[model samples]
Target chain A: MKTVAGIDIGNSTTEVCIGAFDDRGKLNFLSSASTRTTGTKGTPDNVRGIRTALEAAVQKTGTPRVYPEILLLNEAAPVIGDTAMETITETIIMESSMIGHNPSTPAGVGQAVGEIIGIEHLSQAIQGRDYIVTVPERISYEAAAELLNAVQGMVSVTGAILQRDEAVLVYNRLRRKIPILDEVAKLSQIPEHKQAAVEVALPGQTIHMLSNPYGIATLLNLDAEETRQVMPIAKSLIGKRSAVVIKTPGGNVRENVLPAGEIYISGDSEQTVSIDAGAESIMAAVHEAGTVRDIAGQENSNVGHMLRRIKGGMKNVSGQAESSIRITDILAVDTLAPVQISGALAGETCMEKAVGVAAMVKTSQLPMREIADRLQAELGIEVRVAGVEAVMASMGAMTTPGTKLPLAILDMGGGSTDAALVTEEGRVAVTHQAGAGELVTMLIQTELGLHSRITAERIKRYPLAKVESLFHIRLESGEIRFFEEPLSPRFFGSVVLLEPEEMVRIEEDLTLEQIVDVRRGAKKKVFITNALRALEIVAPEHNLRRVPNVVLVGGSAEDFEIPEMLLEELANYRVLCGRGNIRRTEGPRNAVATGLVMSWWSE
Target chain B: MQTNKPAVHLYTVDETLPAIREICAGMEEEGVPWKILRMDGTARGLAYRAATDSVLESGIGLTAGEVALQMRKVAEDRPLFVFADPTAEQYRMIGANAARAVKKKRFVTVQAG
Candidate 1:
């Protein structure tokens, strides 16, 4: 019979299962066993745990057999750069202020310079001459009214340029409504004279006067020469909001060019490539250089060697590229080139830094090859590791049952909680967060001050019991019976310690009732708190309402009160909650291992 | 004693008299032999007695290990089959311990049909 072994290396335990094909091609479960996992669960170092679990299963089955024909193992899924990347992205989005890009031409004519003030100065400034007024963002309608009242007779404020969102606020504040232009990027630059005819363009609309030469001539009431003079202003205002073209009496705008050079590539194969083609495209060509496509459409060895040769040549030339730039020396990272790097000098080598320092110097930046070499030496791992979440999701999908395709699984282990939702089409979305069983255990241990983890686990698992009197006591299992003799003085009036051997006397001061309450309260705080946190993190995008069924199979799920508590807590969602039948049908534990074997049948 | 017809009787303790009489009277109409085994404290003593008797009578065709396993199976099937007036704490502790034991034992079907 062809037998298959499935192994799951978990944080606290390793579970294994053996299955053989019966005469009818049905999977017959032979045996299953669990052993405490040695080393980290998901690491290659967990091989020892896998070996121990396999031995235990073999012993239980009492079958002296060689390694099964096929062995299926759950690939270790590790969190790589997700949380850090998320945090960095969020920080950048929040802190960024100015995001400027030069528009080809801006419309509007003439310069308007004046003291920037609120709408109150508008009436006074509009009496005879033009003036510019600034509207601060976030000021409400009512406040703008009072400010206008206070500045009734101030200097003439002919026109106003408001910040984003301030346009609506100021307009609402005015008793009489005026056309407001929103999202004025260069509001501070508006010149004084053109303020009246300068209709401010709103956020959604384009620069009107700039788009129409006839409109600019009519609004500014300019002669042919004046119209000509204002033509540049109109052109500059083409796409700008709140920008003033100061009639720089003698000012002219000209384009400046920074020097750029071609990156030359030389290899044993005499292949020339352009740096302007983009790094990814270049790398794709480099990777496929010498490979030839077979009838099966797969690259053969000849092409593979060519690609390797190019990669090797590229690594050697990277140093030369970096030195020629005369900024920071570059090296190619062995593991994950093209994604990350390490450098002694900051600005020039990094893309993010390059953007920041572009105004200072025009230094030539080297190709990615140099950066990859330096990263390989420093990080020990590859420069550009594959996305950890993506890898785990693919591996998890491969090991899970095909019939239950598109299923979501939460690996609630000790160090981290990993959740993967696989689609029927084979796409997988995965997320990972810190805090799970270990965190709950830590909470219990800290709260109870339990000396042993065994004791803490026991406390977490059980309800409570209290000795009512010498003659009788109440058990949490809903049992009450008369003692053959009077209860021992040690057990009376306090919660009895049920540890094997070493009976310690309970404190006589506390009543049995008080002890029961304390234990229940403590367990509730620790277990429930951790469970909710784990659930929230695992399914963050969707509410619990969407997750209709939750199959809990973990070390913590074995706790007596935990399952009941979870059932009650998740009752609102009407989710079907219970232990996996895999353990019941075969034996306790080894569900993941069994699933792995079953996955082979599916494939 | 010489008659071929079966006979039925009901037994009751002072504390459980009302409940016992209600159940016995209900069964008596159907002409079934019903008895209430009562004890002073919790129902645990009665359950223990019942379990012990059931184990002995059922032990005729099974090994000692099989007898114990069967007893546990019966207890799981009808939890009230082995009733105990346990305290809140003992209820929590023992229930949890028993569950842990069952889980550790890897019982295929904890509650026997």
Candidate 2:
């Protein structure tokens, strides 16, 4: 009887499966475990994670620190995924000419155009001059309201900008109601003595005049050139509740098309495409190149620097020569980078077009024997480097209930998306593509303008909900969840990720549907797109319809929505697909590890 | 002056509540109309009874020692929020959130500390 433990080291995690052949020659998998991987896969550093995962699996089998008779390690996928974003367009505001925000409690309604004046300067104002009072944070609501009331008869104060959260307090006290914008942090930045248009939409509505370029031109009395310059500012103000546009004739908003430069794909033919051409054209060029042998970028350019950085990164990781590394696949996605408007008083962000690229890197080979020898020496056990990752995954996938010959398996991991197919005659075909979980996170981060990558990652991994009230939440599926106790007030009126234990608030101001739409759109862009590409390469004669059943096995396959999404997408091609349940027990996990052990006995 | 508009009613036994300004500002920020009046009674009992009598079906009974947010539809014994010895900030949140209940919007978190 041989007790064997199969270990699969991945970019993000390490998984272990312990199995033993009984005296009757029947195999039984005692337990499976997973832990965060210590370092890059296919390295000697993986031994630490391997030991942790093996110990966890051993604990599950009611044992304490028992090394298996033999350890089977998967030949980790050779592909390395690196993602970078290149800004194609930048929004440059010339001066403090715009203010756009959805302050939770902006007061009053309708639009007003006036000369921007400080509250203290109101005492010096003359009659017939329309003015907007800028109230700094130091001015109390009562004091500001008293001043506005005192000047109402003398000066035509059409609007008010408040630095503190007192727009409603001042608005409620006013005799003649004027549109008031509050929570303006940088009140001093609103260009002094300049003509500005301020608009506050009615509750539950967005500002129309300030959001439209032509409307802004009408309010500020701008000519054609000035109107054209404010288009990007107006674009950034869309869907905002309140906005202010100061007319500076010198206030130039330039939509500069940054020189992102071109990438060269060397394969069947040398193909060159500029990253500034956006994702569609870049992807077309990459696809046309047909099996990229190597990719290079122009010197001193954004794409060029990105390529060199990733190549340098790969060299550091695998200790391989930079010239030998090849970029096999590139998933280029068009995304909006939230570039902060330079001179805006409010911290407003305009969506600028950016190319987000995740490319797959691989060397001719990885030194798996070196890692195997180190692990064996440390554990004092026989450790063998197992079969190719995809083939072993296919063997483990067969342990799933009701699975038969001629099966295709898709392994979606953190770094790469891989697909493998095994025919009835045992002929295996495999394909590895770039862009998986990390790419999806990049898309979410760029699209949502979330400040932190951790926040973006949480949004990618969890479902979202809008905290509607103290006790209830409206989920992404429009299902209402009412809690028995009062939820935290900080989460109220914001979108939150529905984690298992607690509600984590998302800081972005978006509707639940919009956030879910972005999340799923990102998933579809990366996973669904890569799914089709992978299936085509591994399917019979590169035809998806010829493929039979598909079993999804990977860390990403266990994602709450990915498998269901793939099943729906693959169904269009009439392909049967579902998340794999290895040994009818482990759900879409430990496949590569379990496969390693099974393949060892089979051969 | 005609006070016929629908508004959240704030009732207090003593006329000298220092937290009234904070509470009023909180309600005002949400663009909700409100009225504060002197009522001689326990905070909970007055808020419970006043909730059904107010035009907006939302009422807050405030005192130096306690505060309560009551809704007309909910049972009088089980008010929405009843805090003992709430700070000024808590009173403000109670006022804003009670108005929010009337407006059918999400309530702000009432910090106990």
Candidate 3:
């Protein structure tokens, strides 16, 4: 009997399959283990993680970390850019005066035009001159209401911008109703003596005057040239219930598209596409240049810098030559990332269009022999670097009880999408494409304007809920879940990611529907697009209709929604596909490792 | 027990906690008219009665040791929040939350003083 271990060191994890085979070559699986990959895959740094996985399976009470007689490792596919996701466009706001805030409640319902005056300066205001008083945070609601009531008789108090959430409190005390905007966090930054227009829509409605450029022109009496300059401000405030646009000198909201530069894709012919042309045009150019030979970008441009930086990072970690690194595939998808509006009173953010790119890179080979040699020397065992990622994956996929030959295995991983087809005639075909879980995460992050990737990842992986009340939450499915114990107030009135342990609040200014739409849309864009493309590349004649069974295997394959989404889309082509169950035990995971051990029987 | 007058009911443990005045002022400042009533019970129990008895279906219950805010027909054990040894700021929030419930507005985040 020979005891062999199969180690699949992936971008995110290192998985090991330990099993024994008899003289007749029938394999019996003994145990398996998985650990977080310590470093970039296909490097000597992966040796520690390999040994850790082996130690987990071989550790038996005091028996000094035993090693398997034969160790086989799957060749890990590395995606360029050390990290796969990159945003091609960045938004820069210059000399802007835009405050786009969505405070849940603002008092009154009308448009008011006046010169803004701070509460401290209200006492010295001239009579008959219209003024919009700005209330700071120190003044209590009662104090502000009393002061506004007292001062209404003196100056023409047309409106008010408040630092605290006391708009309703102050509005109720006024004898005459006027529009009021509250919860202005950066009230001090607002020019005190500038001409401003405050508009508050009725309940269940959005502002009309401030959100429209002509409405602002009529309210603030701006000329045609000045009115055109504030177009971005009006466009940003369209759906807000209340908005305040102050005319600060030289304050202009200009949407500048930072030069993202052009990407040069070379196959049989060279194709050049501008990043600013957006994802669709860039993708068309990519498709035209089939089998990308070596991609380049305009020198010193954003795309160029990004490609070179990614190449540099990969070289540092993999010790591969800069000239040797080859960009095989690039997936570009249109995305929107939130950019802070300059001179915004409330740290308002606008979602700006960006191009999210993920590229697949192969360095001749990532020197898996170095990892194998190191593991062999340290463990004093025979370690052989064996099996391509897709081959190992398909061999492991066959362990599924009812699965048969002529099957296609889809390994949806973090950085790359890979597919392999094992024909009934014993022929094998494999292909790798860029964009996977990492790209999906980038889309979610950019579209929702989530500051952290972890938050975006949680939103991508789990279900969401809108905390309608303290005790109840309306799930994305429209079912209301009631908690017996009062939930923490932090989640109140916010969209939260329903993780296994707790409800994590998504702090961005977004509705539940918007978040869900972005998440589902991102998944569809990445997985559906890559799944079809990968299938076509590996299928006979590149015709998906000719393909038969497709088994999904990888970390991303375990996503709660992506499998159903991929299956639903694949139904059109009449291809039978679902998330793979490796050995009917591991749910859509450990495929490469399991297949490595199974490769022994094939030999 | 008439539900005609829509006022956020305030039920306090003792007649003079001094914090009750601030709570009443909070609701009044928010422009929602309120009526104060004295009751002796646990904050949760008093909040339940206050919410059930009021026309607006919103209530704030205060005991010497804790403060609780409730809305009628919600889970009795789970009032919006129950604070132990709540400070003056929290008492004001209790009033604001009850008024917000009546106004169909978002409840202000409650913080202990």
Candidate 4:
């Protein structure tokens, strides 16, 4: 009988599979374990996580830590630059003039044009003067209505503004059917005695006047030049259910375009790409470099700061000098990241197209050797590096119930997408490509402008919805679903991730459709793009059509839509794409680790 | 700068005018030119006459009470519907739903054999 242990060190996690084989080759799968990777993948620090995983597996089987006769580690690539690239795009808010806040219910029907005034002096106002009455929360609807009624002939009450949700009640009793805007949370901030237009859309409608720049110009009687300044304010108010446009004397809106620096691609021939050119042009420059040796950002630029942080992180983890870190492969994806408008009055954001780059750095080979030595000394067993990760993954994938030889496998890991093909005669060809699962998360985080990786990961894993009302939510598919109770206020009227356990609120200025689009776009850009690129390299004669079958293995294969998306994308070549069900039990996971032990069966 | 008027105008009774007023308040501010038409008789008669006499060939009948009975009495061919609980929010939703229904080619159709 032979007992072997297989360890797979991934970018974000370390996994181990231990099993025992009888003389007749009957295998008993003992137990499997996983834990967060200690440092970066393909580094000596990975041994710490691997040991924890190994110990956990042994504990499950009630065996000592050194129970296995031999330990096999994946021959992981030595690329380290996957963490080097950074997104240089920054969201800048140049002005605070836009009032895009939507109050649930604004009263009255038609637009009201008048100067805003405090309700305390309704009797003192001129009889013919048009005025918008601002009613504070302390005033009751009946009292405010009576007060407005008393001055009906004395003051022209054109519109009513209230700090309470009395839009319907006040409108019902108003002597003049002027428009009323209610539920202004920051009622004190609204400037008094200013020319304002209160617009309350009917059921199933959006505000048209404030939403259009020309409408604002017409209402405020601004010339062409002045009209240009109010364009942002008008643009921001589009699609809101209701809005109030108060023309403050010094209120001015400006949208700033921040300058993102250029990227320096060092390769066989050195060249530079301006970050301002957008993602497509930047990627084209990176591609033109052909065999990139390293990438650097212009000094004192957003990209430069990102690259420095990445190097510093690597130095902290691997204890290597930051200057020696050479970023080898870069995957640049065009994404829309949410940047908080610097001077936004209502925390409004505009989607900005930015480039998200994930660069792979080349590190010394000593980390893996050191890991092996440490394992050998601790486990009292022979620890050896197995074949390439992709090849081993293919072998592990072959353990799936229906898989056979002459099949190709794509190992989509957190840091890289690796592919391997095994011929009918057992010949194997493997290729490693930068950009995989992590790139997708990074793209999602950047494009959605999510500040948390946890939220990005959740978005990548689950579908999204917008809680439109207290009791219902609109899914990305345009389906409205009701909840038994009122949703949390934090999640109300915001895009949220519908996780299995509960709903997670996303505070970005994105609708359900926009968030869903960002999530799906990121996955396609990284996984689909890398899948095609990786297949071509590993396929016979670099022809993807030559490979008839593809088995996806690794953590990313567990994604709800990735397998189906890949299947559709690869259908043109008649390629059968599927997730690897290792040993008909483990689904899409533990393939590389499982394959390590299976290699000994043939021997 | 566009001065084109809205294709349809609003018509409502006294009880329902508050909600319609709420709806038009926003519409007028945004240059959505619309006028309100008042009826002199019973709610049902007003809606029926408004639906038939309106030039726009569409009318949104607002009612604070029951709407299903009065709406059923209106002719099916006319693009008119009754909105119960005609608050500001409801009218806004009605306009939104109406716009969507027009785009989807299934405006205010009742399911029947």
Q: In TM-score terms, which candidate is top?
A: 2
lDDT tens digits, residues A196-269, model 4?
A: 87777776788898888888887778889878878877766778776667676567655555677778998888
- Which tens-of-lDDT digit does each residue in B1-113 have in candidate 4? 13324333344556454566555433332322444565454434554554344343323444454121112223433323444444455554444333322222122223231
By DockQ, the candidates rank as 2, 3, 4, 1
Candidate 3, what DockQ? 0.26
Of 1 and 4, which scores higher on TM-score? 4
Q: What ordering of candidates by lDDT runs from best to worst?
A: 2, 3, 4, 1
Misplaced by over 4 Å in model 1 are: A22-25, A42-48, A62-67, A79-406, A424-427, A449-454, A468-472, A481-490, A497-541, A586-588, B1-113
Please provide, for model 3 over B1-113, each residue's C-alpha lDDT reduced to its tens digit, 9 standing for 90 to 100. 54458788888878688878677756865668777778788999999998898888888888888889888777788788788987778877877777777775556765455
Better of 1 and 4 by DockQ: 4
Cα lDDT listed for each candidate: 0.40, 0.85, 0.82, 0.70
Candidate 4: deviation at residue A466, Å?
9.3
- Tens-place lDDT per residue, model 2, A1-603, is 878999988888899999888876678778899999987777788889989988889898864545589998888777788888898988777777788887888888999999999999987887898998899988889999999998778899999999977788898899999999988888887777899999999877899999899999899898898788789878888989998888876775667888887899998888999999999998899889987898888899866777777777677767888888877888899888778867667777778999989888888777788888998899899999878999989998998897898999999988799999999999999999988999999998989888899998999888988876667898888899998766655665678898989789877666777778888999999999999999999999999999989999988898999999999999999999999999899998888899887876776
Model 1 per-residue lDDT tens digits across residues A1-603:
667777665657878777887656677777788888775334434556666777777776664653455555554342210000000000011111111112211222233334334454455454544455555555443465456545545544434455432443454445434344435454444333332343545444555654354555565454676566554344434544433232333422221121212222233232333323333433343333332111110133222233333333333433334223211100001110111112111001111110000000001222323333443454243332122332333333333233254444545455454556555576655544434444445444433434566554555555455654445566656587566655543344445554455323343233345445545554354344444434543443656555534554556656555566767877766654554345345322455676666556655
- What TM-score does model 2 score on chain A? 0.94
Instruction: Place model 4 in a CAPRI quality band.
Output: incorrect
Q: Candidate 3 regions off by >4 Å?
A: A58-68, A78-98, A118-130, A138-155, A192-194, A247-249, A297-305, A467-472, A480-494, B1-8, B13-34, B40-91, B97-113
